[model samples]
Target: MFNLFGRSRKSNLRPPRAPGDTVRAKDLAYLQKWSASRAGVEGFVEPETIVNEMSVVFVDGTGEWTRRRIGGPKGIDAVFQGTGVPLYFAEETGYPQRMRDRIEKDRIVRERLKQRERRARLEQERER
Candidate 1:
């Protein structure tokens, strides 16, 4: 047997709802509906619609967190008024990178499930 050395890569997985924009199907309607009535904000670059799946992340110097679905600026604005944390665009703030990684991890999990199904089918064929 020939052996080729390769490192087994480790994966980091975080729970969806500990904090930050962890959006579910039920929450999306509210975000979309609220953003629908909002006008474009002058200085920031935002997606055309704030889908419920989208997350708004805000952090202050005091180490507190503020996160929720993309319910237009209004959602973040309300959260900010008392919280005193400023909302920054995830794309510009590098939060998008975290989001991108999460999406990639989810895709990998789906692919792994499909592979399991294929292996099960192969075993069934062999038994037949």
Candidate 2:
């Protein structure tokens, strides 16, 4: 009568939460400090999903950004309650163009560095 593919009687049927998946006080504190230090910072609320927890992305005027878990949707208000940074649902407006530009810029820079390293290695082989 053993069923290897069936759920156990005690099973709750919920996916197990990974370690560090839950939000912590330091998450809020880090967001606060990072936002305070940056100018023209804005917050975008990202909804929770089966694969990931609710989180927020803060982008500054220069397109520099950071993301952190906010526990839930309500945590968005709690984090930016008094702060001047505007909050927007990422699902509605989508990410800003500047953020995308910054990402592209970074990617190009990394590719150039990798190319230079490869050239140096080839030169070393040629010299041998």
Q: lDDT per model, in order?
A: 0.45, 0.79
Residue 66 error, candidate 1, Å: 12
Compared with the true structure, what per-residue lDDT tens digits does model 2 show for residues 41-109? 989988877666788899999999999877775576677774557889999999999999999999999
Query: Per-residue alpha-carbon lDDT of model 1 for 1-128, expressed as tens digits?
Result: 22344423221122224134423435444434433344331112233232233455433222223345543444454434433334566567554443456567878999999999999999999999
Question: Against the true structure, what is every candidate's RMSD?
Answer: 17.7, 4.3
Highest TM-score: give the candidate number: 2
| TM-score of decoy 1 | 0.40
Model 1 worst lDDT window (10 residues): 9-18
TM-score of each model, in listed order: 0.40, 0.80
**How many clashing pairs per prediction, in order?**
0, 0
Look at candidate 1 and give me any clashing residue pairs.
none
Q: Name the runs in model 2 displaced over 4 angstroms.
A: 1-23, 82-84
